[model samples]
Target: MRTSACVLALSLAAAGPAIAQDHVHAQGAHGGLGTVVFPNSGKTAAQADFIRGVAHLHSFGYRDAAIAFRAAEKADPGFALAYWMEALTHRHPLWGQEDLPAARLALSPLGASSQARVARAKTPRERAWGGAIEALFAEGKEVDRARAFADSMRRIADSDPADLEASAFAALGLLGLGAQVGKGITADDAIRYAENVFAKNPKHPGAAHYLIHAFDNPVRAEQGLPFAREYAKIAPDAEHALHMPSHIFLQIGAWEDVVASNERAWAASRAWAKQNNLDNAVLDYHSLTWLQYAYLQQGRFRDARALIDTARTLMASGPANARYSLWDFWFQYASASGDWKSVSVADPLSVDEAPDAGAAFPLPDMVQAGVAAVSRGDSARAARILSLLKARRATAVPGSYSNNGYEMGVALIAGGIARLRGDQLGAIAFYSAGADIEAKGSPAGPPIIPPVLLPYGNLLIANRMHSEAVRAFERELLLRKNHSASLLGLARAHRAQGNPAAAMQAYRQLLENWKRADADYPPLREVKAGASSSPGIILN
Candidate 1:
């Protein structure tokens, strides 16, 4: 990521030349010299200079930036951007240690001014930036502050008429709200906003990332896969970006594309890590985990195992916190592999471990609920409890932990169980409702486990919409190509379509990908047997 200063400098540099063309004007301190420029032209030179100072800090000149920021603010006390810049420049340790208190104080005026601006600004960008500033403040592990920020952002977004930045900011705000609600936002809404961003500006910086989130739409895999491919092409160096949409491809049953995306993510992460000395075990884990999954999809157990070992070693030596994330990767790996014992072996949590289990917060009871549900075949009970847990999330307020995705996943599971019990309509309704909410933009967006597409694909399959199911599976593959469950869903869809050849191929692919399952593969011996036996196409 570019430093704040660098981004600011770039933005200002682009505008600076334009400013020079305007009639030069000077003002002493405050209105003592009176307003020197047209009110329609926006702030004067001194006010903008303060904002530039904030951006300068990103270039690693904090002291200089701070001095300039102070001088500019002193000259133009009512300037909102100046306060915003002051807040951003001082918020983090650009050069050394951070001064959070001072940062907050500096930005406080910006927040106030942003509110004022939002109330009166005629331009959408001005209003949107107000919301963006508030949304930025909504971060942290809690929900209250996050929700407030989200609400503010939403207000700004709703007020704007097709503003691209508003779309982005709204997505971010909604994501935060979704987290507070314990499901984040509806995946549909998130995608809509993301798409709005792309529609508004194809060259937008984070458009692909937001678009990747939209694949949660059960019917968007076909379109999403192509989008993900294009996104990867545009941002070849963004490892996380490359990996995110690949999972969707997996859901849509695009095995080849899934493998390609995983490879891209892995390659990007590896190269970036080597070049930047970034000890990002999380990024590496995501990359390698997907690779292992791809291999398993190909039924190459040995290769999957090799990748797992390497991932484990890399994570173990990377960082202490990284060790904990490894647990999730390994857990997913084991589950896919059908090795229940490995779950225990790879368990990073101990009695001595922190209460949050490395997430630095309280562990969500849903974790236990999910474990019990998955462990016991009481999917109904699991689903029910999960729904309750989600519904019970804290309200959107400052400093609360809502995590909408967490709730959505539970609801999705409930819907999945309902579908498995032959209630197709009920399942669709549940999944669809959660999907709608998850679609909104939240700070954290959706939960990784039991992703929306997981139940979505299953529901499509139960309805006997094999082609749609295939598309869903492919979409999931786009987000996580190595997701065994998605691969299995694709295989099932192929079988249901009566493509015996395709079914066999998908099943074999599932078997290969099963190797990447650190041990989570549910050990269903009859999966392939049933898949192979029904050479009959059962498309609805």
Candidate 2:
């Protein structure tokens, strides 16, 4: 969103005057917020608050950072950098969102105009920093603002090689540019910039955190492990830093690590909210969903189901994403466990509790009723669902991660329809298209559920294309390591292809992966039976 000159002027004029007041906000040690060296000329209280805000900013704890920055403003009204950092918090380019009006308002109190704000800076470096952020909120399209900010930040970082904070901001601006203009620039370029900072300070929270985002893919997941291992430790008090390690853990197939990471994140978020006298509705949902998926992967069906109740309880009053996250968990559980019989039967929530269709988040697929209709071979309903999926995908920005995600959804629905009509060849073609799409944007977006490869492999095996099925399942493993559903399909494909040894190996791996699973989980029992029957198979 662009705030035009006229709009910005009116906003500034309305802001009228700058008044500094003392308040008791942003207090607390907030210890372990990683390391940063941002020297400023504010008074002692202002300096402490500004440094704390920088720490929160590095960890992507924007709200907390804003509070800290506001506290600094209270401590020292003339601290130009505090409003600058507060303005920065209002713009989240990585999340593809920014409150342009709120951002302009944040700056309005700093000065009557951009040039005035820069003039308020006590140092040339601070002036440069202020100019870069002002360009970010400049009058133009979002991409133009990002490009301008990236150019300005690049200059700032170049001007002072010793400025670690400048280098970090430069890297972040580039990342924002990537997210704003999809498929043009990417996180890869930003990763190189962040790598330089990381080399100098391994404990820098932003450097470590950005590296994890850049390396969130099967090919580079191991590379992210170093940063992921240290980020939470660097900022153990921040909810986002604690949760971020799971991104690498999920990509690398570290089930236990994913579980542990999200568990701590969810708990910390709740603890912070309660301590601050906030409602539970402010708790983070991203980690909650990841935690639920980790439980399903470990075959903890009861635990996964419990989250469904939690999701439903919050859908009525929690954040807008409550419905979307609830449905994501629902679809993931049903598909992963292959327990469709208990899907609607055991679910405590009614259609109203978690509606299949809503204005909530605009998820393109995973309409519970639509998937059910496909399963029941209701051709008319399936076609309607497919049309809706295509329409949703069309609305997504081209070459964007969401575009690819919705495209995959459209392909899956088409494939499901083909399978329902008994066109095995047609079904395989659609699933293959989905697999191709999945491979395109895995590194950039929020996780895509029910990986396209799972159904593609199952269809290949159904067609007696055993070797092709093996390749498909192998690809699935690369995308999501130790996926039990894919593992089962891989074992079956191997057995069908007369590779008894390979089949036995896959089964043993499945058994081990499911060691924490409930004994009553049917898939675990089946894998155990197969392992027991195969004498040459190694099982511990």
Candidate 3:
């Protein structure tokens, strides 16, 4: 899948503004794709420089590319390709910040004659600039215009199946348009028809990645699992295959399987990175980061620690650039370990501005109002507002619609606030609503955001459903590894079921791990405070 906008924005934001003195800057100054300066290539050093900047963009090098492209445009006023490349650079996942507007701005300057000339071009190189512009419309959710562009690209690619570059670029545009409109099946059909182009030429740029995403849907994902595995076998060194397997394991809550798949990917990819000295710092950080979670899941605190130590070492060697998303992972791991200090330092919610769409329901204020109303023992008003929030979650955009985890988390927060307000039944009602969402698969099952499970499991334990609570905690622990609250929940459930030894064991482990870990856990600060010193059990 194309990197999500959120990932792009977050990565860029974390990386901060570009640093000027890096040795790496010069390497990216020259385009990786080597230029073809034909006679009348209209090619100046400025155009070549701009195209080099465009090449850097393929690997999330937006910050530096922006500088080069802008300078190139300044050098040559009538350079349409500069403008075109500038526009394409923003289509990078990082461009999500201001993509729709940037796309419109890029396409605005092309004269009618220029577009017409592009449309009539006999060769794919002549048309690459124009086709890419149309793909931007598709990115912005403009369906009709996107479809026209896809049709044009398709015709050009079909005309010369032997021209692999044109075929690959055209395939990419079609796949992108398909994804935007949720008609990815059209992309699947088109790819199957053009499979010969790739069969004859395996190393075509973008072809392999585009085919993997566009054709690997629900039905085909399962049917093509064999081929995916085959791809792994054939390209034994490929990191792309690793992402799919790990993600699939995650989706099914196969935590151990996820660990194994990620390990293989880490082994294969990291070996390549270290050997080539190719951005090993950032990639190694993430690899070990995943390993940390995997270790934590299996109750291997020592192993988890080693992995985290490795990540920190690699990150320290880098330019200290990046949003340090690795910090979020640390927070999550620490939270599971019951380290409130970690939570305080990292402040998980520090970056969590309530999503803009939440304005439609006024969630922060509404949650606050509802909490306040319940504090005054006004269950009716609290219920009304929460119900409104729930409805909005149900009806939002499909892609934007968060899973039950967010709802579950919200419900838990609301319920806790209500309980503090001295309205136990009101709290129970909210918990029950969240539970219903979880059971109904609205929040979804398996591969869910792990933190969301804590409150739901705690609510189950509070309500005296010992087995259900244990299962909930177990399911969550499967994903999280060392979740402190889950361990606490398991302890409580065991205690409730007359398993004193198990309960004591779980509680001791939680306390000991939290004490030993760095204390940056982001999720369970509240729950840990509530249950930390309490010995036996609190079913209420």
Best by lDDT: 2
Judging by lDDT, tell me the better candidate of 2 and 3.
2
Per-residue lDDT over 20-65 for candidate 2, one digit per residue giving the tens place of the 0 to 100 score: 2121222256878877666554666676678789889878788889
Across 373-424, the per-residue lDDT of candidate 3 in tens digits comes to: 4434566655555565565567555442253544754575578667767676
lDDT of each: 0.51, 0.74, 0.49
Residues 1-540, model 1: lDDT tens digits: 212211211111222321121212222221011111111113443544553352233222344456667776677565555555465455332112345567667766544454654454333334445455544543454456555655655554455434344456456445445544543244566667767766755544345555655553344555676566666544443455567666566655555666677787788667756665667453455556666655655555556666656666766776654223555554455444544453333332232333233243223334434543544467755655554544444433323334554556555666757656778888777776665454442321123344566567777787788887787777665555445577678878877776667766766666654434334334334344544555443332
State model 2's lDDT. Answer: 0.74
- Stretches of candidate 3 off by over 4 Å are 1-89, 93-129, 135-208, 211-221, 227-245, 252-289, 303-326, 335-344, 348-409, 415-458, 466-540
Better of 1 and 2 by TM-score: 2
Can you give the lDDT of residue 426 in candidate 1?
84
RMSD of each: 11.6, 7.5, 12.4
lDDT of 3: 0.49
TM-score of 3: 0.52
Give, for candidate 3, the lowest lDDT window spanning 10 residues.
3-12
TM-score of the candidate numbered 1? Answer: 0.52
Ranked by lDDT from best down, the candidates are 2, 1, 3
